[model samples]
Target chain A: MVAKIYRKCGDIDTKEMLFLPYLRYNQSMRETLLHYSFDDSSSSLSASGAWTLDEVERLRTLLEGYDKKLRTHSPETLYLDLSQVTRFDTAGLILLRDYIRDWQQRGITVELLGMSEKMRKLYVLIADAPQAKIVLRYENFLAEIGKATLRTLQDAYAYVQFLGELTVHLLRLLLKPWHLRLKESVYHMKQAGIGALPVIALTAFLTGMVIAYQGAVQLAKFGADIFIVDIVGISIVREMGPMLTAIVIAGRSGSSYTAEIGAMKLTEEISAMRTMGFDPFRFLVIPRIVALIVVLPLLIFFADMVGILGGMMAAKWELGISWHLFVQRLYEVLALKHYLLGLLKGPFFAFIIATVGAFRGFLVEEKTESIGLQTTASVVNAIFLVIALDALFSVIYTEWGL
Target chain B: MSRNVIEVENVVTRLGGRMIHEGVSLHVQEGEIYAILGASGSGKTVLLKEMIMLLQPLSGTIRILGDDLRTIGYKEASALRRSWGVLFQFGALFTSLTVAENIALPLKEFSDADATLRDEIVLSKLQMVGLKPEVASLYPSELSGGMIKRAALARALAMDPKLLFLDEPTSGLDPVGARRFDALIEKLRDTLGVTVVMITHDIETIRGIVDRMAILAEKRTVAEGSLQNVLQSKHAFVKAFFKDINV
Candidate 1:
């Protein structure tokens, strides 16, 4: 029957190469092609040519078709003759092994024949090994939502724990200031505080000018252009200056903190510190937090000064309000409480940024990509917490009638 | 009767104003496991890097698979690169991708084979390197030192290249694991018919499976050949290196 199929094609010399019903030679030049002759009545199959990596797809399709046909026919036994296989590799062998396993599962006795010594060794090595299932993880929408919510809660808990540890370490260092890494603190101040000066000044200056211009437009309609000083002074001193400086520091230094600590963690430097009897929190976290705490208030103060200067300039240009009159109005109306209130939020914002950044750094896994991921999370979390804390401060201050 | 798969001649390399390899030369024949041996600062790695075209020698010629490394075009160079595989010392598996994806990456990029076929090839290569199929979904960071080496080897063999380059393949493994690694390399060479070129300091690996070797010392090839042929040299480094191993 197999020979008759080839004879019908009439492309090859089937009579010369054909041996029997179960042994028909496939005279083709493609070394990777697999040809099989199946004797339907006896359930005997003879396959020839190459069974290698290149023939994986074809071999799979052929074996799958045979699997379906075998299921329909319900053959008691399947004899697979591979004696004429010209080439073989692990790819081909694995596919054959899997189909054979499937056939056995379907109550068909599969017998492998004409196994070479090399093939037998390969068979024992690969076939006898314990197979592990490939698990691709998938979750429905609700499960994903639950996992995300849990992750967020876990993150919040971890952050609180990190803050508690930081406070303990801070108190310990406060008792012995000599144990504090003063040099590292100074270095971080230079990086996060001094290095951030120019950008903060520029952003705050522009923000003050925009506010002055917008407020002048509205006040000029009411012929109360002098009130622009009140709007710019109160907003920049009490809200804009501190919040903008914190957001900028969150993006710049907070990201750097996470990346630096995360890289150190990935390289096992954090572990090395612990093994060497150095408290990583006191050594790494405290220096950054102290630096930001000391510097952020100063940064906000400087931003307030630059922002008031910008408001003076915009007021003079847009509303013809003299710089002297603006200063007089600022001194009178923008009370010391407003300036102190803005400065007061500085330490809280700094603590949030530094702690969130360093805590995320500790969460980095061993992979380099984890550094990038944690750094991004650090910046985002710092900014979010900074804004939320500012809102809380506003609510508390308003309730207290500050 | 095997042809020369790699041939280096009178190579000179200078890095950072220091003469690393004044004049070095070596050849690796097809179907043989060749070892490049030297001390820490002897420029053995520099020579290997030069052979693989990562670093060019100041003056010399390296003919790999009959193509001159110095003057080869970009198209020809990439084509030649696809015909061989390289395994770095630290496994260098992409941290972002899983072990299976790392192994299947080259197949996906270089071949027209679909995802299913690529997955099968990945499993087959994993089995070839004696790894459990379950390890396929694991990341490089999750693997132990030995498993990382095995996974990296599987990835290197993904394209079924004619040549395999290994850098300190058994450097970090325990004695038993190192011996198993050497056996696996030997078996792979026999089954896959690939020429193996490796840089190693392991005396056991040098004695166990190396068909031929070249000892690099003091900026040149001090000795080159089979164990008997290399032992014939009276070089001080050669004698000291093999003194403890009684092969």
Candidate 2:
């Protein structure tokens, strides 16, 4: 298909621009409409893929002018990311892809950067991707990397340092009697521990029953169906109790702490505290950490008992055994080490939750969206760290023969 | 008459490549109500916050009450800020605490200043702003718009701070309320003998109470001194700041 190319300068070879092989301007500009003669009823219906090679060249010429205009007029460097172009089977995409490549080959600086998976695949299909030399107006690869590097470096470094500071604060509170803040400590326990009991118990109970029901079906085949109590009790007491409690605390109280601090930061209330002679660590963080360390274990203990009972109920019903037999088998298999192991993990998990939550909150970058991000990051990081640490502890304890 | 008490010298502040404030230097004198009167986002809040070292300058010095604020640590900054009071743009009185508790917070936190001392201070401050001490027990959620402003002003003055930083004091108040607010500010200044730095776009606030004005345009000081001088200047941006205030 042939299309007309608008030439800005005289004596330019039309054949060199190979991308000029397709596309049609369905609607003509005033000058083009006046110059081009068309027959009456040349189509009452509009053209869909009625594009010609000349029209494609015309588009290229117009787009080149736009590129020049952009460079001269607007100071902002545009990210012409192609990710929005979902699908392509037409020469329109090929023309754009080619122009970008041609500009690159000629060492013409591209102020615009593109990002498109579809375009990327298409570009790779046609050529080994155009190595466009981006003459960035403030957004070079290094500048962008430097930007991301600075942001990530700042975010990660600040987060790590903040976590360290929080650790020191927590250690200081634990070691020194002076900064213990007993009253605030009690208040935090209520916030992080006691406040979370209902949800933790409910979740643990359901989880235990689910685990027991599954285990009972397997054990009944071996005529060792009575052992359903062992799996549910052991798992709940050693792994699920502490881990689930920690996750619940992270999801609930962790998000709460992040949001609270985030809101304070957004409103400059935290800044107000700094101006008012109060260290946020001492006033805000110490209380929450103390609360979590003291309270999360107690919640886990409660969850453990509730979970075992729930498991016993599931086992008794699934195996058609008496409740008393289930209780005997549970106590027979459940060792004090399992109880101790779960309790030990509780304080560690609580520390991670409170530290991550408070750190995420303090790290909130003073905006509306930062609060949400901090809250999400706090929960995710807390859960991930909790599960990871639990796995490590399990391995360590198994080797230690605990 | 520049009774200069605060000296902002070569202050440069930037956030992620864009300079929010640059080479912004200005002064506020003792006993005079200085206004950083710019059409909002002229870095008025940024400048105001720098007075008490809320936002640290990237490269400059701010002398508040004859002491350089930048050299101080968190403790020192708080101690310096304790002597001054700030009214936030959002009327940031503690929503959790009652109006009385909100006003009494600084004193309670920093001082063992008794409940009796607090009650007396809270009552006096509330009365100073035309709010009854009876309304002291009510939470911030319960207060009306003008009341919240008065309460916020009352909190700002509760500590008897020698320096007061108010960001758009009459922003949410109605015309009558805003006028009354301006009057209240005047009365408070006269009685307290405190240096005030107000950032406001309210024309009435300017004409009525402003002793001197600084206009921030193009990320730096466009004009400084009396309201009349800034309004009359050949600088179109400064002129537009005043001209647009009425519009």
Candidate 3:
């Protein structure tokens, strides 16, 4: 296939095989014709893209090919088919009309086999007197049952795949041994979970201080500056702790899972597991999930504590509140519900992070790009799901009076 | 100790549209080094992978040690895993583990041996592979390409299994190092009474020590037996290959 393309590109090395794939105008379209569709199955002698003038140049060039090739060889029916085209603007009009004239002058019976309505209308509009006389092969849009059926099947396939992967994820948690793969899984969780403690702690603490300072300044005018403690404590424990923990995990552990698995896949290390009579999930996935399940809640606990303490610093100085009252109000605001809520969401968040990370890794298609793509998608998708689910929980918990 | 006839009966593996290994099969006798040889994409590694149960065949069954891996559960599969050892192409030595710890993986796994005994065994395996006891403290990244291969071999030999598998045992090595490593494999195979199977594209490794050679080709690929039989194959692709090498 590549060799056949080299013939079209006029003996260029693979390096010179530059595809001006993102064409914007006629020169770009010509560049694409010169470099892009060299081995494409769909391209006839001519295919057009991006711009009308380029499309016309492409048509004129294709028309010239018949005259040039047939002048020496025997003549055959040449088609000015636009059936493959899906859209058209005005400039495609003048080029086609001039092309038709050029073909007639050369005594070639070049038939316009297929024209979209828009293309035909554009040509007719260009000829203004309404005598473009271009033939239009009308195609029924709804009658493309084949493509529609394929698309519907593809969508259904994607949906079924989602359900299948979901089931696999659940079964992996339920059925895989907690005793053995714990070490391997926890090994990663430590790097991703426990090891990230210092930074996450500091981040939460600084964030708490910042939020408290802002809250104290606002509350001071209202003679409620002391309330900054409640704000920081309640917010960090109930919402920020879980939210921040997940986001941190997504960035740290999630991307690590993706890159680790990506590199494993790249190196055939996953396949090595298969040869060794071990499921990759057993050796790699199960362990990571179990460890995170065990550790994420703990990290969230620490993050909450750190953030609340940072809040306390602001409560003491800016709010002119003593440490005792600040601690008291903090304790008052932090109900068991807040702590339970954050911890309850721990395993769920871990599950999402692990699944998204592993799924992205699984989604890699053996291209160099898949490494960055998988890692980026891992964090983005994990964070998105985390935020989306958090909103759902907020709605549910509020309605449930938690 | 036992002759494991790893029959890959009518195996077929496909990824999307391409048929990677079509109806590939091979048999290895006890105390024999069955070398699977091919270029990078010729599915040699895939064929060897089946021996370890890494790849699933779309069709056919793989019988290792009189058990079908596909029929077994995870625990059962893992249980049977100790019977064979695999040396990955890049050594796949746990970068986190030192040379001794890496080699001790299988021994620590299959045996209920004490730590001191395991450490002693690790030392012995390293010695057999011509590594000094002091080198055991170094991690995989610290080792040279040749040392990594040896450490991986030591790990594979840790269990003293009935069968051992190595992928590209001498790849990325200097010629002298490659030769020395090949000699170590030869020496270990003789003394250990272990069935050895290797995936290699190294012609010199094949010539020097491979007992039987599986030349992975197209549909007619994976012809295995004595090295002489493969060298004299009449298949056009096989014939032209040997002709190029002037074998």
Give interface RMSD, per candidate. 3.4, 34.4, 39.1
- Evaluate residue B239 in candidate 2 and report its C-alpha lDDT on the 0 to 100 scale: 64
**Tens-place lDDT digits, model 3, residues A226-334:** 6787788778887888889989988988898888888898788888888988777667776777777778888989998899888888777876788888877767776
lDDT of 2 by residue, B4-71 (tens): 67898888888677797878888888888888866656677877777766677788888887778867
Off by over 4 Å in 1: A1-133
Question: Pick by DockQ: which candidate is best?
Answer: 1
- The per-model lDDT (C-alpha) reads 0.86, 0.72, 0.70
Tens-place lDDT per residue, model 3, B4-117, is 557667778886778887777777777888887766688877777766887787887888877886797888788778767788888888876678788777656555444644
Name the 10 consecutive residues with the lowest summed lDDT in model 1 chain A: A12-21
Each model's TM-score for chain A is: 0.82, 0.63, 0.60
Q: Which residue pairs come into collision in candidate 1?
A: none
Alpha-carbon runs more than 4 Å astray in model 3: A1-402, B1-4, B73-75, B244-247
Q: Model 2: residues >4 Å from true position, as ranges? A: A1-156, A170-178, B1-247
Which model is ahead, 1 or 3, in terms of lDDT? 1
> What are the per-residue Cα lDDT tens digits for candidate 1 across A1-402?
353323333432221223223222234323433333334333666667777665566566667655665665677777888888887766578678877777888787888889887677666655754344455566999999999999999999998898888889888888998988999999999999889999999999999999999999999999999899999999999999999999999999999999999989988999999999999998899999999999999999999999988899999999999988998998889999999999999999999898998999999998867888899999999999899999999999999999
Candidate 2, residue A186: the lDDT equals: 89
What fraction of the correct interface contacts does each predicted structure contain? 0.24, 0.00, 0.00
- Which pairs clash (backbone N, Cα, C closer than 3 Å) in model 3? A26-A54, A185-A287, A185-A288, A274-B53, A274-B54, A275-B52, A275-B53, A275-B54
How far does residue A137 in candidate 2 sit from its true spot (Å)? 8.9
Steric overlap count per candidate = 0, 15, 8
